[model samples]
Target: MIIYQSGLITLDYDPATDILFINWPDVQDFLVPEIRQALLILVDHIKSYDIKNLLIDSSRASLDIPGTEYKEVIKEFGHNLMQTRLEKMARILTPNSTRENKVEEARQELRFPIPLRTFTDSKEAYSWLKGTLAEPA
Candidate 1:
């Protein structure tokens, strides 16, 4: 079921798998503020629902956040996530795309590990989050 949605974000939940799928179809060339707003709302939903698993699909969306600001979004998002009950999170990014590199860089800049990863394949991500598949070795 869709918990919250707007022009920039769409959030869907699968109760059976206990997974929250956060879609960014409207994130094309979007900025930090827009993404930050969406993240805040997303985290709230997680807190309110006691969400433990998450799949963030960004394969179709593109962000335009500049250098430091891009890291800002990731940092803030990661920081907020630490306060939640989330067990694991996977992100789906378009394979062989610049966005993939950017996201990885931002994640590394966090300077600490979190139960999050980026994937290019949705099915693999879903399976991993569902505990039916293991993280790629």
Candidate 2:
């Protein structure tokens, strides 16, 4: 079942399926410091949960962080797990091609070890990540 910690974030813990759903908060604008704090908090939360497979739903979120600042924070949090075990990191992006392109560009810039992809439809994205015939919960 999914448990919303607050408006800022929510944790979808499906122990039966062994999948952790992480919903990034909807931030109209990006603030570097706030992003950093969020990342740190996220890392801790994930560790606490001991999740192996993570499905990140970033459809409602926007990342407007400066490259340098983002890099520093990501680097600080970078380790084996950030790259590993995060089997499928997918983003459901807005319709704007340019904005979508920007998100893809940022993903490339981050250079995370895990495979990252973006989709316009959340259901399709989830299906792709969860596989063609995953038994529904």
Candidate 3:
């Protein structure tokens, strides 16, 4: 069910899978503070529901926040997630090398305890999240 909907993002929860799905808005550029605010909302749901998985469909959005600001957002989000039951997160992204690289960099900087993966295909992303595909060794 959709728990939150805004111009910048939409959040849905799947009780059976204990996963939270986030649909981010299509934007060429976005503000870091606004993204952080949205992430905080997500944190609330994660904590409230004891969500263990997250699937973020970002194929329609391209975050244009500065590198440092982006890192800060990731760091803050990671810290918040650490307090929850989050065990894995999968992101669906458009096929852009720059964006992919930035995502990887952000993931590394966040250093989240949970496993995180990015995919170009929604099916593949869900498969990984559902444990249908084996995790990388």
In model 2, which runs have C-alpha deviations exceeding 4 angstroms?
Answer: 2-4, 63-84, 96-99, 133-137
Displacement of residue 19 (Cα, Å) in model 3 is: 1.6
Query: Which residue pairs clash within candidate 2?
Result: none
**Of models 1 and 2, which has the larger lDDT?**
1
Residue range 1-137, candidate 2, lDDT tens digits: 76446546677777765566777766656566666666666666666766555666766665565545544554655543464445655566654455555545555665667665566776766666666534447
Where does the lowest 10-residue lDDT sum fall in candidate 1?
Answer: 94-103
- TM values, all candidates: 0.85, 0.64, 0.85
- Cα TM-score of candidate 3: 0.85
Q: Which model is ahead, 1 or 2, in terms of TM-score?
A: 1
The alpha-carbon deviation from the true structure for residue 75 of candidate 2, after best TM-score superposition, in angstroms, is 6.8
lDDT, model 2, position 66 = 53
Model 3 vs truth, CA RMSD:
2.0
Distance from true location, Cα of 68 in model 2, Å? 6.4
Residue 59 local lDDT, model 2: 64
What local distance difference test score does each model get? 0.79, 0.60, 0.80
| Per-model C-alpha RMSD | 2.1, 4.9, 2.0
lDDT tens readout by residue for model 1, 7-94: 8887899988999998767465666677788899999999999999999887766565564666667778888888888998998876
